[model samples]
Target: MKQVTEKFRFGIDIGGTGIKAGVVSTENQILGQAYVPTGAERSWQEVVPDIVHAAEEALKDAGEFMENCISVGIGCPGTIDAQTGTVVYSNNLNWQNVPLAQELHRTFTQPVFISNDANCAALGEVCAGAAKGFQNVFMLTLGTGVGSGIIINGRIFEGGGPGGAEFGHTLLVEDGELCTCGRRGCLESYASATALIRQAKRTAKQAPNSLLCTLCKGDLSRMDGRIPFQAARQGDEAGQRVIREYIKHLAAGIANAVNIFRPQAVLLSGGISKEGTYLTDPLTALVAEEVFGKKNSFLPQIRAAELGNTAGMIGAANLSQ
Candidate 1:
């Protein structure tokens, strides 16, 4: 393995709302942290400089000169060509084949690496989190939609160009709810926080006398996870239905992952995952039932991600090795 300290690596995580950059040590400790709004309205040309500025700020915060840095890595949300360091497409950024790595190299005068956000999260897991001691792991991020990363033998296996792991898009039902990826019956159609919210809204609309309806103030559009979860705790049948179905869909996805990768662990992140055992415990039981793998202790253990929002950048920095 390349020595992490032989050269400091800079990591930049460009999210839908903000950009986080930092100087990270080989041991996976963040030496410095800095942030800036993503400013979605700005074009990539305008965005590149903002990323550069964030990197510069991180270097300064770490009391390190630019010359000491080995490489700069970016974990971007998009379909990326990791081999070429190009953004093939991004739903949120609306960027296409933006040569972010090339642009960063031109601006910061250092080698730059870029990868899909899900892959970056997996890298973060292997580098510093639950998978640190293991070379193979799966990271499932339960956010507005589901995202996944597969780390095999300490490296991300990108299928062809920019694809890492897209568990969310896998079809679970025939002609289910439409997905942002333009697909129907995607796992995300039933399991994502957005999906949960949609379920809640429909239930709220029908159960006008329910507490969820009161929480949403009779507005279906305003119904969301918080209200549903609250209603579930308050023993509302509609909330219970939403949560149970969401868990089932999520479990099905995890079980599929287990059968495919046989990873050392399955890590979860994002706000929805914060539901904790309410999700993990049952998901584990479902995996035991659904996964085709041997009923042995070798089954992947599911856990929550420790790095939170910064996991992407942390994983990106470790890519320098």
Candidate 2:
């Protein structure tokens, strides 16, 4: 009888601006990593090769080869059809119905799997990050926009088909701020980093003497999600107002999700999450106060994501398993 050799897995996280690839051990440790510019404006024919090359470079960094890899997993931003391994639509990449899995399979002999990047991030956290011990979780990445991922029974939940856990798109206000999705009053319109910056700029324009304006050197473009938090910490009323309003909408969205799924934990990721206690402490209290039946039911724990940007790749690597 022949003995089997242990093999590693390759994970690829594809984004509009960059593509990240890594060789992952079964224990979820990243053995090697590589990054490449996405050149998203080009056709898939041009971009797919870059993804393949990134994988090769990552394997080289790990001192391994295709034979050493058990499989390949790709986490991409889009409406991914996991069954067909196709990207139904990705507004960021302008991709529609691309056969991503098939293309990767042609490049490597190993099996290829594909899923939504946000879902992959959630899985990564559940497997190795903040939600490691939790069987059910909801992950929110508050970046340029709000991205959400859901995990149920330790598996990514895509609802009946694909593209379900869009927690950011839930309506928060009627006829409110316009969202990137061309809708109005979405949770993302108020809770995302973009929204925070917009609020800061608007407030700064009204109060030029504000600390937020001073921190930005009188340039609104220089304002970011951090300025408001920093200003609030320094006792700036405008900054405090922005932070309070941001947390209100964020809590509303979180409470809505908690009421529906009641996951074991709700994890947050992105630059804003780096605020540590400044963000989590208040956000936790707000959610506790707002979640339905919180007086009688167990409230989900809220914490920052441990894996950060690596979660997508780690989760993608485990998709084949």
Candidate 3:
């Protein structure tokens, strides 16, 4: 086996819109990166070749050859069978039962590893970003939808199967809003940026005279996560209401996760996390109040993810290490 600190690694992050690849050093440094648009409508056979092209570009940019890489790691969205390096399903890419690692291995002839994209993000943070010293960490990403990653003893924990730590899909309300996963009242339905935008639009509609309506110039479609937070900062009643409720649901989910895993820290990522202390302060208070063992047990520290968009690729690259 090669020492992790003595070799270069290739990391690939597959997303709905694009595929990002990076040549990373053993020191967790990204030497070079490249990206290609994902023609998701095309077959995986076509997509796989594009992925290879992107990797070659990254290696070239890093002034290295494929032979210099010790292994390749892939972070993809879906139920990933890490042991088999297969992607069982990915609604965004319309991929199902794809032998992703095997496909990559055929092209690169290197050891290949695969994992959930969110899990990769958590691992990235743990290895090189915010959770560096923590043995246990939980990460939440509030994007178009909510995504979660859990790390225990510095390793990704996928529960008993391929898809675990799916905090976003956890039920928050009984038969409430419909979720993208065909479930009702999942945490994503209430705590995600999508949910924030929805709440902002509905709030503006209900209170036509509120500042939230004016912020979007009365076009609900123009409303976004920032608008509500901005409006709330300006003392808008409707905006404050929207943010408050959003926090409530988000806190509930965080508390639930804390109660179960009790990690050393909980890191927040994605667009909403940019709110910084405005979001964290309130969230910390709420979680302290709601977490099951808050009064008697040590509480996990909550903070924002430091790596931003690079976490997935960086984490993927380190997987082989």
Q: Per-residue lDDT for 113-208 in model 1, tens only?
A: 888888898899788876778788888777788887888888876775455467778888889889988999898888878888888888778888
Candidate 3: where are CA atoms >4 Å away?
Answer: 1-6
Q: What is the C-alpha lDDT profile of model 2 across 109-218, one tens digit per residue?
A: 88899989999999999989999979999989999999999999998887778667787899999999999888999999998999999999999898899998899996
Model 1, which residues run further than 4 Å from truth?
Answer: 1-7
TM-score of each: 0.93, 0.96, 0.96
Residue pairs that clash (backbone atoms under 3 angstroms), model 3? none
User: What is the TM-score of candidate 1?
Assistant: 0.93
Candidate 3 lDDT over 1-321, as tens digits, reads 122323588889999999999988888888888999989999998999999999998877787767788889899997888888999889889999999888887888888999899999999999889998898999999999999999988888877777766889999999989999999999999998999998899889999999999999968899988999999999999999999999999999999999889999999999999999999999999999998867567788899999988899888987853
